[model samples]
Target: MSRPTFKRILLKLSGEVLMGQGQYGIDPETCDRVASEVKAIVDSGVELCMVVGGGNIFRGLAGAAQGFDRASADYMGMLATVMNALAMQNALEKAGVDTRVQSAIPMASVCEPYIRRRAQRHMEKGRVVLFAAGTGLPFFTTDTTAALRAAEMGCDALFKGTSVDGVYDADPKKVPTARRYDELSYDRVLADNLKVMDASAVALCRDSDIPIVVFSIRDEGNLAAVVGGEGTATIVRKPQA
Candidate 1:
C-alpha cells in the first residue's frame, strides 16, 4: 500500500529524547540535532507543531508518589514541559525556523498563553508552534495534551517520537522476543494496555480520528523519514472495516 500523506502534523516528543546519552537534563547538541530534523520537515512544506513531555526533568505522578502534593507536583511537571518547549524553540530558531511557544499555565513573561486561534495563525504563517503544559490541568499526561492540541489544530496525524522505533507487544529493550507492530487498532492498544500512549490520549486520538505514528527520534534524521512515510514506525488508528 502507498504510504499515507500529511499536510500538517503534531509531533509529541518525550523529555527523555533530550538527554542525549546522559542520565538526565537537556543536551544542547541533541536539541540542535532534533531542530535540524524539524527544520527539514518544515522546509518540505509540512506544517508542524509540537508537544513535549517532562519525564527527563520531573514527572508529576512520580513526584506525587514521593510525598509531594499531587496538584503541586503536576504543576511542577507542567513547568518542566515549558522548559523543554523553550529549549526547543531556541534550537529551532537557531536552525532558522520560526518558532513559537504557547503555555497552558499562562506564564506571560516566558511565553504566550495557549490560544488556539493564535497558534493556528502561527502555523498558517509557516511558524512551528510548541504546546506546553498538558491541557493546563493536573493529572493529564502530555500524551493527552498532544492529542488535544492535534485535534484543536486540525492536524492530519500525530507523530509520537520516542526511544523505540515503534509500538511493541512487550518492552523490546527488555524482552528479546517482543514483536513490533506496523499498525494497530486503537481499541487493541487500550484493551491490551499496549502503552503506545496513555489511555486518555489514545482514546482522544481515536475519537478525533487522528492516526498516531510512533517512531524513534533518537535516530538522527528519522523524524523527517517518518514524516515522509519512508521510515520504520507503527501507526495506530481505528481498524479498517
Candidate 2:
C-alpha cells in the first residue's frame, strides 16, 4: 500500500484504552504513553484533534441494559467522556503539548463548549483539542462524533485507535486464522457488518470522503507509525473499480 501524507487528522480513542491493565477508570501511565505518542505526531506538524469514548467509565447502552433510563444513562455516559478528556488533557499538557478540552454538553466551568472555529484556531496554534460528550445527544456513539468533527475540522483522515491492529474478517483474538484487511470499502464494511466502527460513523465518513484508519493503540509508538503510514493498519475508504 502507498503511504498517505496527511496534514491534519482526528484520532478517535476508546475509553478502555485509558484503563491500561486495570479493569476500570483512567491509568496515569497509559495516558502518559498515549500523550507521548500524540506529541510525536504534533512534533511532525500534523494538526490533530481527538474524540474519546466513555466505555471504560460508563456506556449508555450498557446502562440501559441494566434498566437505567436510556436518555439519562446516555447523559451520564457523556459525562464519563468528559472525565476521560480531562485526564487526557492533563497527560498531554504534562508532556509539554498544548491541549484543550471541548465538550458538546457545555460545562463552562470545566472546559470550553464545542465551537468549531475555536477548535480550528486551537489547532492552528498547535494545540490539540479533545472533543468530549459524544455529540451532546443520546443515541450517538463517540465514533460518530469523531467522524462529524473530522469532517467539520476538514481533517485529512480519521485515525481510529483500537485494541486490535486492524479490521479482520473475524475476531482476531478468537479466530486464529482470521484475515486482516489492508484496506476495505466503507460500503463493504457496513454491508458485511465488519465492526470497524458503528454504522453511523462509517456512513458519515463515507459520505464525507474521509478515510478511516484503524490501528492498535495498545502497542506503544504505533500511533505515530500508523499516522506516518509506516505501521500496520486497515484503511477504510471508497473502493476503486
Candidate 3:
C-alpha cells in the first residue's frame, strides 16, 4: 500500500528509544531494530531524512531549568546527539542503507557540517541523512530542529517516531480514558495545547505548512507500514476533508 499522504519525509527519533531496556546509552539490539525499520522504509523507495534527539545522553533544557548554565548544558546535549547520530549511522550502514551524518556544529573530522544543499543532494542520491546538534544553539529542542530541517529539505511531512502511537487528549499512560486522534489539524493542536511536541516546534511546522505524523518507532515494521499508508498514528496538518 502507498500512503496518499506524503512523499519525502523527515523522521525524528528520540535517542532514548535506542537505550532499549537500559536507563541510557545506545543498546545494540535496539539500534539494530531501529535500523531494520529504516531499511524497510528505504526499500519502499521513499526519500528520507533523519533528526535525532539526545535525551538518552543528556537533556540540556532540563539541566538548565535545574540551575545549570544553559549554554554549557546545551552544548553537552549537542555532543550527546552527535554520539547518538554516529551510532545510528553505524547501525544503518550495517543494515545496508547508505547513510550520512551531518552536524550543525562544524566537525569535519567526524561528520559533515549541516549544509542544506548537501543534505538534499544526499537524499536525491538515495542516501539517508541524519541531522544532529539541535540547531547549533542552546535553549532549542530537537523538535524545532526537526521542523527546521523538514522545511529546509522540502520534506513532505515530519514523522515523529515516539513510543506512543499518536497524540492523545491526555497522557495515555496516566489517563486510561484518553482519546486518540487519527487525524487532526495543526490549529487544533495549538488551541488544545496537545503534547505531541514542543510548542515552538509545532508552531514552526504549522508556519512552514508541514504535516506531522506521530507514531511508535519501537513497533516492528511500523516505519515501512506508515510510508505504505498503513500507519496507526495521528496525522496533524492543515485542515482537510
lDDT of prediction 1: 0.94
Q: Estimate each model's TM-score.
A: 0.98, 0.98, 0.96
**TM-score between model 3 and native:** 0.96
lDDT digits (tens) for residues 114-188 of candidate 2? 999999999999999999998999988899999999999999999999999999999999999999999999999
Deviation (Å) of 132 in candidate 2: 0.8
Residues 64-117 of candidate 1 have per-residue lDDT tens digits of 999999999999999999999999999999999999999999888999999999
Q: What is the C-alpha local distance difference test score of each model?
A: 0.94, 0.95, 0.90
Residue-by-residue lDDT tens digits, candidate 3, 1-241: 1235567999999988889889979898899899988888887788999998999999998789888899999999999999999999999999999999999999999999999999999999999999999899988889999999999999989999998998999999999999999888888998899988888899899999898999998888887877677878888888765
How far does residue 189 in candidate 3 sit from its true spot (Å)? 0.6
Q: Which is the winner by lDDT between candidate 2 and candidate 3?
A: 2
Model 3 scores what on Cα lDDT? Answer: 0.90
Query: By how many angstroms RMSD does model 3 differ from the true structure?
Result: 1.6
Off by over 4 Å in 2: none
Model 1 stretches astray by more than 4 angstroms: none
Model 3 stretches astray by more than 4 angstroms? 1-3
Q: Which ten residues in a row have the lowest lDDT in candidate 3?
A: 1-10
How many collisions between residues are there in candidate 3? 0
